[model samples]
Target: MSGALARLLGRAALHAGWIVVVLAAAILGGVCIGETAIPPATVLQTLANRLFGAGYPLDRIDAGIVWNYRLTRAIVAACCGAGLAVAGVILQALLRNALADPYLLGISAGASTGAVLVTVAGVGAGAISLSSGAFAGALAAFLLVALLARASGGGTGARGTGQIVLAGIAGSQLFNALTAFIITRSASAEQARGIMFWLLGNLSGARWDSVLSAVPVALAVTLVCLWHARALDAFTFGADSATALGVPVRRVQALLILCASLATAVMVSIVGSIGFVGLVVPHAARFIVGVRHVRLVPAAALMGAIFLIAADVISRIAVQGQVLPIGVVTALVGAPVFALILLRARPAR
Candidate 1:
């Protein structure tokens, strides 16, 4: 038994190592192919100056582009993708449902609703901007679902996962309608543009301050999720069985929903709604490695980073000189890739 345990651990570690290497390569590849491909030597120098503050003398505009523009955007994209994917794995595990993702559960929609509301209604400025509003929106959605879940005739039964999903669907439709309404009612051109950009989702607006704002939320939420991996593993066999094995089922369920909400809200707030990374990356990670939550969570996060980074790079080059919204590129790439995967997985149909 000890030897078998060792073997399993060894296998998971190997997959994790490979995934890390692949993700690093993809990030570097993305840096290479974007709008202004800095010469490798200059790229190194620019990066060194930005990170270590010790590169050769650099031009002001070039330095600004490297330090102020590209690196932050790339990091934010990677962070957003990773957080969503981690949240995806948690949802999938909790519900014992393969199709579960953080956005699919309507958290992203709720966050988007909040951002649009702020843009339309005109909210606070500076530090109290979009991300806070989006977080509040996500919290609202989670509370609504929680309330509905416990109501009589709702999904409070043994498998409350279905109830949660139905609530998410309802939330998505309602918020989407609200978003369109705000867009239609917009008096100012900038308001409409803000709404549209939030829906389309991109990291082009990533600021160092905003990126810093997101990092701790993302990191704290991820740690909370990581701590609960064992509970998630127990969930695979169903809630009752997990409880039978002394897992605190209700507490874990609430924690998963809460932490995932925080992560999703912050991600959507900062980067808009880059879809399919959350949905696709976890499944890809699960396909390559096994579904053990320990490896699965980090693997999904890493793969998601790579997925978004690569997709954003493609968006840059997909059209000559025009930077398409990363969200659009993700859907365009994700839909066909996911379809092919599903087709391949189907039983020789």
Candidate 2:
């Protein structure tokens, strides 16, 4: 027993250390590898000068590029990645399905619809504006899904797995259709193009205010998730088993789902609906750290940060001067990985 525990600890430590290093490297890479290509030392000095009074003066343009653009973008990417991954973890546990994710739950579709409507209607414009619309849409979707699931499962939050999945699928299709209808009928071609980019997820316009807000919120949500890790682990054995172990199966399900939806909505509001980070990262983290949510949640968050920041970096550099949408890159990567996971877990006929 002691030997097994030691080995597990060692592996957890190694994974945690690597995640930290990767995050640091990613931050440096983000700051230094842009069009300007600032050196790492210069990036550090500029940041130090801003934070501390260590008077190392940099070219104003270089400082602005590092501080105003790349750093902000990287922070936002990390926040989005971490938030989405944890949301996936919570959702997969709540729904008792490995394949569950925010995008799968119709939350992303609802958020996208709301944000698109806000933009199209010219409701608000600025760093902090569209989030309200996105949150509203996400909440609406959550309620719809819950209602549909409950109705299908005899009007209770303790919905059967099949009912919840079906509800999510139906709700997602409905919201997505509504979004398409609104865009096609109400938007100009240019507006439609911009809206499509947002739907596909791009972080090129990320700013410091967004970073400041998103990072803290994402971290807070992750902490909340971690607090419920034991309950989540209980959930893996099915609700009946969990209930036997004194878990409040229904209440826990509702709480975690709501929290996950809120986190997903917040991320989508900032960077548009970047898919698969939530779906793919948690599963990958589970592979590395096992099914225990205590280890899985933090690992997933760190891996998520690394994955999205790396993706953002690739999106920035893949096209000479033009940035590709991050959702496109993630989809290309996630689709094949997801297929592989499903294949590996394919049940015996």
Q: Model 1 over residues 304-347: C-alpha lDDT tens digits? A: 78788877788778899687888898899888877877886788
| Residue 89's lDDT in candidate 1 | 85
lDDT of 2: 0.84
Global Cα RMSD, each model: 3.4, 3.9
lDDT of candidate 1 at residue 301, scale 0 to 100: 79
Count of steric clashes across candidates, in order = 0, 0
Poorest 10 consecutive residues by lDDT, candidate 1: 149-158
lDDT of 2 at 108: 91
Residue ranges of candidate 2 with Cα displaced over 4 Å: 1-21, 122-129, 153-159, 347-349
Q: Which candidate achieves the best lDDT against the true structure?
A: 2
Best by TM-score: 2
